[model samples]
Target: MRVLYTSIFYLLLPFILLRLLWRSIAAPAYAKRWAERFGFFSALTTHKKVVWLHTVSVGEFLAALPLIRRLQADESVQLVITTTTPTGSERVRATLGDSVVHVYAPYDLPDALARFFKRVKPSLYLVMETELWPNTLAACAKRNIPAVLVNGRLSEKSARGYTRFGALTKPMLQHLSCAAIQNSVDAARFVALGLSGDKVIVTGNIKFDLSLSDDLRAQAATLKSQLSNDGKHLVLIAASTHQGEDEIILDAFAQVRASSFAWARGAVLVLVPRHPERFERVGQLCASRGYSVVRRSEHSWNGASDILLCNTMGELMLMFGASDIAFVGGSLVPNGGHNFIEPAAWGLPLISGEHLFNFAEVARLLTDAGALIKVNSAQTLAEAFVRLLENDSLRVEVGNAALRVALENRGALDKTLLVIADYLRKS
Candidate 1:
């Protein structure tokens, strides 16, 4: 099965490159780093122990930011980081510039993996979440490098997909030195998928262990003031929205603003699309709906703009902190949802759609704690917004719940660091 899979992958390589080229029409960065994907970057020559950490994209990098910083404090290892997407690479460059040796991750082909291993020659590899690749794992095993899966999660939908290719998936998982899973359910899923019980430990989610500086909070306040044009404008942020979700969110925004309540009438909706490629389309979509849109990159958001289109990178945290209500997107249209941890950490009341399978446990915790509100349609979403807007105390109650839940889950970062330290010591 492994050989067959490799052969099939080799056969599909051209089509994959072609697809990247096609996608580059909208996201040009995809076309820029072809050599890096083939593992042709300059080799590291550091005498210190080298550790490589891979994050697929921005969300994972943001989630692992605290952990990455923690590792940086220990100068014994030369930290090398790789991101699969250009946006992710951009984030790594912008946030922790020169702190780690950043590069694009090599493709899953054996040749690319061999080149990557030869260049970096890392002692330990930490891959975030579900970024498991068969060839990558096989290379790590062959090299005797400890590859740990940090903040691991396995949804049932993903489990079924893995079950389909059990032969390939099983050995791929077994190659891991250990998996620091997010929850017991995910840990159980790893065991079912062929990871040894002792090799899988539930370390919770490091996202909950985020560190927000006082400066960031002040920046958030300043942004809120600017968006409101120094007036009293109720801000409702629809964050990380997907393709099919923006329309529904706009409809909800319209409904919310049309309500008889004066607060609703003066509300400003901050729309942030999930991907950079969709930013222009989303802005046009808002304009088509007769809403006055403000692009963050073009100009500052003011009182005249009905929707603040957040097209900038690395500012979602500020947006979350600036808003009174948050609608975490991707859940509305079966995209399995993005992380709601950021907004929750800000003590903001969150609303999401029914499709939260990817974050099932986290959603359940927030919902059970009376922090998260679930909605299925534009009408329900509007009602959720109106309910909180009309009752300030209700918003406060939910927000407090979210903050408490986030604080209660804070030790995950420490646990995750301990696990990494243990593995690094062994290797």
Candidate 2:
């Protein structure tokens, strides 16, 4: 089955390259990293054995940052991070600077994996979330490199899909030195999929351990003061919005403004589209809605724009800090929403759509505590916004609930680090 899988992947190589070229039309960074994808890059410092940590994109990259910092502190290891998206690559560069090496994760073909392992020669491999590439794991196993899946999660839907290919997936799971999963449910799923029970442990979600730095809070404070003139206006941020969610958010914001809600007066809406490629489209969308808009990258808000388009990257947490009310996107559409951990940590009143499989447990924790409400449509979202804005008691109640949940759910980082320490000790 693994052989067949590799053969099929080889057959799809052309289509994959074509898809890269297609995406490059919007994000040119995709075009420039062709060599890296094929596992062609200059060698890193060969003096120290590299500890390679792979994160798929921005969310995974952010979730891994705390762990990466922890790993970097160990001067015995040379830390290198790999990301699949340009945005993640950019974030790694901006956040870590030259402290760690950043590179594009190679395509998971055998030859690519071989070349990558030969060049990078990682002593230990850690993959954030549930990115299980058979070729990559096989290569790691072949090299006798310790490979652990850190902060791992497996939703039921994903589990079912993986089970369909148990022959291929089981060996990959067995190849993993450890699976430091987020919850017992994920641990059970991994074990059921052929990972030994001893190999899989519930270490909880590392995202819960996310902390807002004083510097970030200060930046948010300054931006909030500048934008709202020190609480003169309410700030509504629809963050990580998808293609369809922006239209709904704009409609809902318009409805809120037209409604009799007193807080709607001079309210500013910030639309932060999830992908950088859609930044221009979102900016145009807001403008087309008759919103006077200012891009965050331009850094010149006239204090008059109805909508502040956050075109900048690596500033979502800061923007969330400034929000009076936050609507996390991806849920509004079928895409299983982005992480709501930041908003909860910031103690903001949160609203999301009904679809939250990606963050099912986190959403449940917030919803059960009255910190988050799920809206089904634009009208409902508008109503939720107006009600939350008008009722300070309700907003405070929900926001406080969110903060309590965030505060209570921390310590995952320590537990996760313990798992890594065990792996290192055994290896």
Candidate 3:
């Protein structure tokens, strides 16, 4: 079955490459790292004991940062991190530095996977979130490398697809030695899919451990001061926003601007599109809405624009610190939402759509603690924004609650490190 899957993948390789070429026209990183599909082969020759960690994109990379750091600090292991997206690669490079090897994961074709396995020769493989590739898992199993899924989550939406192909999905999941899931719900779902209940442990969401270093916080503060001149009444930042969400946020921003609230009178909106390819589109979207916009990539903000489009990578957390409130994107449009914990870690009051199945546990915790507001539509989002902005006392109350929740969830990294260390020792 794996061989047949690999053959099918190879047969479609040319078209895949062509599509990637088309995407690279807008996102140059795609073209720039075209050969990175075979990166594992090249990396394997240098390190004696390689531990491979796969993260799909920026969010997963951020969630795995502390674990990556811990792995690098271990003298017995050499960490090799793989990410599927350019943003994820950029984040790993920025955060992990020279301590770990960074590469793009190969396609799951047998030849590619075999070459990758032969080169990297990983003793252990750690996959972040729910990125399960049958061929990749099979390759690791064949090599006798213990593969584990860390920070695993199984949503109802994803479970449906898995159940649709239960035969294939069950065996693929069972290949993992263990799955350190994000919550009890995820654990239950994984167990239902034929994984041993004993092999699935609820570790909470690792994203709750996200925090900016003092230097990063200081830099963001400086940038905020430069942009606002310390004069803006409040700043509402919408980070990692998707397509429809951006329009909704813009409408909400306009409403807030027209509102009677005191803080709304001088409030600024910072819009950051989720993908780099859409940065210009987002900037244009803001401009078409008749707002003076400043692009962070091109200009040092001077606080004059109605909105600041943060068209840069690896700075969302810093941006979170500079803002008074945040609306996490990918939620309103049912993309399952991005990490809300980034803002919460900074004690910034947050707003998000009702659909946060991706980080359901974290969302529930924030809602329970009165740390976040859940809005289902544009009007409610505007109301939440205005209410938080106008009432400084309420903002501070929610902010404190958010900070408390973030602090309370800090030990996942430590616990994960213990598990990884044990694995290394046995290996």
Best by lDDT: 1
For candidate 1, what is the TM-score? 0.98
lDDT of residue 414 for candidate 1: 92
Candidate 2's residue-wise lDDT over 1-427, tens digit each? Answer: 7889999999999999899899999999988877888889987756766889999999999998888888888877788899998889899999999899878999889898888888888888999998889989988999899898999998888899999999999998889988888888778888999999988778888998887889998999999988886888889999999998899999999999998877876678988999999999989988898989999999888677788899989989999998889999999888988888899899998999999987888888899999998999999999999999888999999999998998988888899898787766655
User: Comparing candidate 1 with candidate 2, which one achieves the higher lDDT?
Assistant: 1
Name every residue pair that clashes in candidate 1: none
Ranked by lDDT, top first: 1, 2, 3
lDDT digits (tens) for residues 1-427 of candidate 1: 7789999999999999999999999999999979999999999999878989999999999998999888999889889999999899999999999979999999898999999999999999999999999989999999999989999999999999999999999999989999999999989988998999999889899899997899999999988888766758789999999999999999998998899998888899989999999999999999999999989888766677899899999999999988999999999989899888899999999999999999999999999999999999999999999999989899999999999999898888899899899878877
The residue-level lDDT of candidate 3 at 43 comes to 46
Ranked by TM-score, the better of candidates 1 and 2 is: 1
**Model 3 lDDT, full chain set:** 0.84
Single out the weakest 10-residue window by summed lDDT for candidate 3.
39-48
Candidates in order have lDDT scores of 0.92, 0.89, 0.84
Candidate numbers, best TM-score first, in rank order: 1, 2, 3
lDDT of 1: 0.92
Candidate 3 residue-wise lDDT, 1-427, digit = tens: 5556667778998999999889889988888766779644454555457899999999888888878766767787888889998888888888768778888899987777777777678899999989999988988888788888998998988898889878778888878988888888888988898888878777777777766788988887886776566855688899888888888999889889999877887798888899999999988988998999888887766656788899889878878888889899999998898888889888899899987988788888999999989998889999999999888899999999999999998777777766777788888
**How accurate locally is residue 96 in candidate 1, as Cα lDDT from 0 to 100?**
90
